[model samples]
Target: MAMQLPTCTGIRIRSMSDAHVIFHAVTLGILPIVSRRLDIEERRYIHSGCVCVWEERSAAGEGSSVTGIERWTDGRRWGPSRVRDEFLYYQEKLPEFEADEELSALIFGSRLIKQTYSVFVDTPTGRRKWHLGTSVRLRARARFYLTLICMAS
Candidate 1:
């Protein structure tokens, strides 16, 4: 049986084997964006039960990029070292993107845009509805932050 623990955005710790612990992380937003931001090619493949992401000019073409994740069910043991390395690599490289407002908004909700908007002037009922939508978004954001904080400690 494997045990898993959520660490942070896109990162987790899992025990898939008695001999090794696996660190798994899924890139946030779009893989192409992640590849560009991290200066990697936007392609993914599974090798020895571990997924690898990088640009392969030969396989694709010069100046061309492919973006996607691949999964397999061959039942090979997940290479813990490779998984851990990927987790650490992303952990080091992703902080800036994670903090970016545009990127965060892509994953989270937009802060500036109201959840609900009126086409014309706001009537009292329209205003109330807008406020309700805003409040719901605020609550969700608060909950997300709270969860992050709790996970950190």
Candidate 2:
């Protein structure tokens, strides 16, 4: 609903009761750096929480619906300037990801919110990718890990 997000610019999503699988698939699909290429020095964190399905939802309801919300901030800064570009690229992709029929279904169905995100980066010879995504129903743990991948191109 009325989400007063962290000062940092990011994407927010809501998933269904069993949206773990879908969310992860969608996230990994976007993480260009991770899905296509990967390297070491890579660690992704996932935090799940609940939030309102509607933009008008309340904060009281958005209590960590995100099951896997991590960041690539470190990768953005320490990696290469191209890495920062990756972050910006994915940050811009959030709306499209959320617009997917499947994503909309999971988030709206839960009545419980799911928030996940990450910042992307295109390092030199090496690349770093990180993003946080939430799934209400992580019945499958893979959903948790996969959603943490880059959510941008």
Q: Return the TM-score for each candidate structure.
A: 0.15, 0.18
Tell me the RMSD of model 2 versus the true structure: 20.0
- Summarize candidate 1's per-residue lDDT along 8-95 as a digit string, tens digits: 2221222223111111122232321112111112112211122222211123342233432122122222222222321221111112
lDDT of 2 by residue, 32-70 (tens): 222211122321221224211111111333433322223
Can you tell me which runs of candidate 2 are displaced by over 4 Å?
1-109, 120-125, 137-153
Clashes in candidate 1: how many?
Answer: 1
> RMSD in angstroms, all models?
22.6, 20.0
Question: Which candidate tops TM-score?
Answer: 2
Q: Once model 1 is optimally superposed onto the true structure by TM-score, how far is the C-alpha of residue 44 displaced, in angstroms?
A: 23
lDDT, candidate 1, at 52: 22
